[model samples]
Target: MVEKVDLLIKNGYVVTMDKEGRLFKNGAVAVSGNRIVAVDKTSSIEQKYSAERVIDATGKIVMPGIVVSHCHTHGQASMGMPAEVEMENFYDELAKWWWPFLEDQLKKEDVYALAKYAITEIAKNGVTTVDDVMEAPKDLPGVLDAEGKAFLEVGMRGILAFEATERISKENGKLGIQENVNFIKKWNDKPDALLRGVMCVHTVFSCSPEMLKEVKELADKYNAWINLHVEESMYEVEYSKKHFGKLPFEHLRDIGFLGPNVLAAQCVNTSDKEIKILKEYDVKVSHNIQTNMVIGVGLAPVPKMIDEGITVSLGNDGFYLDMFETIRTVYITHKGVLKDQSVLPPKKVLEMATIDGARAVGLENDIGSLEVGKKADIIVVDLNEPVPLNNSNIYGNIVSFGMGKNVKYTIIDGKIVVENQKVLTVDEEKVRKEAYDATVRIWTRNGFL
Candidate 1:
């Protein structure tokens, strides 16, 4: 008897980023009801399973969907604007430009519109799962809800949060916390929802110790993942020492806030002792390579972190949504900084983008790699390489030559979200127009227009 499946993808080179690193030249994946039923050689899958829909992935590379451990869905509006500013460092840019722009000019409509636009771009870039931090304290009441709506409309999977910070005011901080809590309670029980809520503390400098403790307690109560920035700049470390009388990681550890569920971004200035503490607590790190490079923050000690058995994953950090560029940046950044060509091999970088990233976001068993019974989050990349794409050259081609524009299909939760490089769930042009209008409004409000 033949088994029936909802979809069958065949005739591709499948890179199953599993524990054993399995690869099949002529491969196929069978999906049934949002779960992968089987992954095997194309002939075997074709003979055993009959499907209602089939995607002939000829001359394509099929792999697990890219996972972004940290991103800012609301920062899409500020993408190109930061580049034009001549600033000394990240702190200067944040204080003189970015923070003022966000706190004063960002509106509710801007959040919603930018989210739709961001998710659309992310889907096109082959990112299926994202951990998004929404930071617009001025637009708090339903800001997260609006972003959630955008994610649902775009048919992408996301773990969303409102970055609660006490720097603005006690009332504003309370509102931010309430926003995250309310969104979590509202969506946590929903059946088969694609977007869920996570807890976010902006940073140690912005969030008081009390606020951090309270957020940690809330995460513990709800059993949720906590995403936050940690030691992203020298200023943050200096501030932590000045205020808390200890390093940021030390203070966090002393407060009992470090844990396996915490996803800390940046860590560019972490010390050896701090790295040890991170390893001891098993906290995950989200490496935003492009953002760090663009902002001139020092490179993260990823090679050392990996050696210590720390879980480090790739993230865009709202700099750009393209995971392909992120992967390449991570690959070459470490190599160039360390002056060693052997660091960060292509295969390892790919793993960071996919499997390691899923683990960072606490979705390892569900959506990381192409495994049976895992959620069907997959992408098809058209290599379009001049040289032959075989087992040995596949990773090199992906890292060096591939771009997000080469993504032909993005599938999330057994649904085709992007087909032929176009988003299917939302109106692309309308989203783009609204995003542009919102950007203009925000720029005008900030006097940048």
Candidate 2:
């Protein structure tokens, strides 16, 4: 007798982000509960497992859902504010814009409404997982509470960390650490909770040595992931040189901050010595190609870092959350920056979005691939729109030509979160309205409007 399946995605091209990088034509993926149980020939899977729910993915590319490693989603409401005329550095950008918006204008009710809005938009873009470094208030307990409630209400897979910075009094540092610990304790071992606690020290330049050590120790005590920004710009690199007499990465290494448990968001200004130290310390890199190019920061040495056996995942920073653009940026930027055409191939770029991204968030074993025993987190892209089949190099073509509109469905943890380009969780129109309203309020409060 054949085994039963809860859901089956039938007759699609399955892209498996496995060690061998497998792609199966006319494939069928069977899911039992949250885990994928089989990937085989369509006819064979139908013969073996009876599906309770079936999705006809004909002429669509079924692949792993996008995983965003690091992002300031706490500022999702303030995304499109007009650029200030006198913006000088990243610190200025955060302090003048993002920080004040979070501290002053962001209402308690707005957290849930905006979170739902952000998650809806993100899911529509086929992003199933995100590591949201939330902006915590310097003197407010309610802000942290509101953020936790927002995460719980959305019911999405995410890593939430407090955005710790010493821009305020040193007492806020202790409060930030306590907030992380309290949140971790509350949701420590919940089976169905997809939210994980993380330690986020904004960046090396913004954090004092005491602040960095405190958060690191707290993270270790709770066994949570340490997410930090490093070498994101030339200014940060220069600041470290001026202040600590060492490069930023070296300063982190000397202070014993870089580790396997840490996810360094950006290293746009990293030196060869920094990359070597990163490899030695087993730190993961989250490459935000779009953000780097937008800010005119120097491009990361991605090809060299990958060749050195370092894992580099794709991220969008604070702007666009689309992985397709991120993947394209990785491919185009590296080739152009290196003056070498063979820098980041399509297959490798795809890996960075899928498997490598999963590894960055510490969930590679669960999702990130169409493999048995993995969670059925997948997206089906409609290929019929931009017709004229190119099956010969379809994988490469999908990366080059595919957009979020092509995503016909987004499945997360065995549940279809999006179908036919519509979000299943929240009211789309309401969320969009809330996002717009929040944006206006944030701008007015920050005097940006």
Candidate 3:
């Protein structure tokens, strides 16, 4: 008298990533609709339930889908623009090239293609959920809707917002504020929405204290997440001391801006005292290891943050969407800097990409792990290794060798969104062409042609 389910993934090494760090050597996950009905040994699942679809995950790794804690998918189209220019420092790069030539040049019409193309790329790499901040100040009103349409088209999960700030004119900043409110209003009560909204600010340097408090109030009203960059560069620390006579996180704390709702990205220039403040407020850190290096910013003290018991998660910062690289970089970079190979082990890095990430977006109960009654967001990775891939060595092998191409299947919400390294929700060829068209249109406007 076995029950029937929609999908049963069998005979794979299932990394549960639960509190006990469970691993089923020959595991199966039974899905009923969008929820996981059971997770146990394959033989147990075979006796307990029958499925409409069964995937034989032989020689593959079955785990929770990667959750990107921070992203700027809008910048996907601007990749490699101003190719000949050297970015000497963080502020100049953003002020001169990134903010002006890219965010300013991006038009409303280009949102869908860039978002779709970028989201699709991340999806195929086993990213089921992403928290994104759009920066198109030139087209603020209703532009987040365009991003929503792109997420809907791809059938992935997104927490969307326009990075609201007062760096521009106060009027434009008000527009940014209104845009976030509008988006949040639409997603007010939809807890299970495939596309959700978060309130975003660019940085403390870019946003006023009053503006920061305003966003916090609205975000609390909706119980929504608030994301922003903090201590991503040394300039922010210097700016705070010169203006407010305190460190940056202290400024946030004094203004009553530090809270559990905040997902702060890149604590690269933060001190140990700042880490304590972050822990006090229960703020989560989104580590952008590669982006910090590429932008010439200092490395985040992720090892210290983790050691201090703060929830540190991994993000691309939208410089690149490769989750494998993000995971690997965090694994190796900290060890090199600390000169301690024991720091940021593969297992911890795996948690940063999955459960810790879910915690960052406040979706830990839903999407982060492969547990019973959780959302069925999972990835089947085929490392294609010639050696043994057991539970003891699996975490290391995947972290060391995994790539987008190795992701043979990406299952999100009981639906197969990507299979055989191809995205199934949208037309790949069509997206490629439109994405290129949008990039060209943007580049032409930026005078990069």
TM-score of each: 0.97, 0.94, 0.98
Model 3 superposed RMSD (Cα): 1.2
Cα RMSD for candidates in order: 1.6, 2.1, 1.2
For residues 204-269, write the lDDT of model 1, one tens digit per residue.
988888999999999999888899999899999999999989999999999999999999999999
Show the lowest summed lDDT stretch of 10 residues, model 3. 80-89
CA shift of 282, model 3, Å? 0.6
lDDT for each residue of candidate 2 in 1-449, tens digit (9 for 90 to 100): 88888999998888887887777788889999888999887899989998778998888888899888877664677656675646788767666766765644666666656666777777888888887776655445555566666555554677777777776767776676677777777775775566777777777777898788877787778788888888877888888999999998888878877788899988888899888998998889999988787777778888989999898998877468677877777888788878898887888888888899999877888888889999888899885655554446776787787787778889888888889988777678887887778777667766776
Best candidate, TM-score-wise?
Answer: 3
Model 3, 1-449: lDDT tens digits are 99999999999999988888989989999999899999999999999999878999988889999999988887777677764556666888788788877888777778878888888999999999998888788887988999899998898889898888777777788888788888888985776678788888999889988888988888888788899999888889999999989999999999988889899998899999999999999999999888899778889988888988999988897767889988988888888888999998899999999999999988999999999999999999888889887778988988888887899899888899999988888899999889899999998887777
55 Cα displacement, candidate 2 (Å): 0.5
Q: Could you tell which candidate, 1 or 3, scores higher by lDDT?
A: 1
Error of 1 at 29 (Å): 0.1
Between which residue pairs do clashes occur in model 3? none
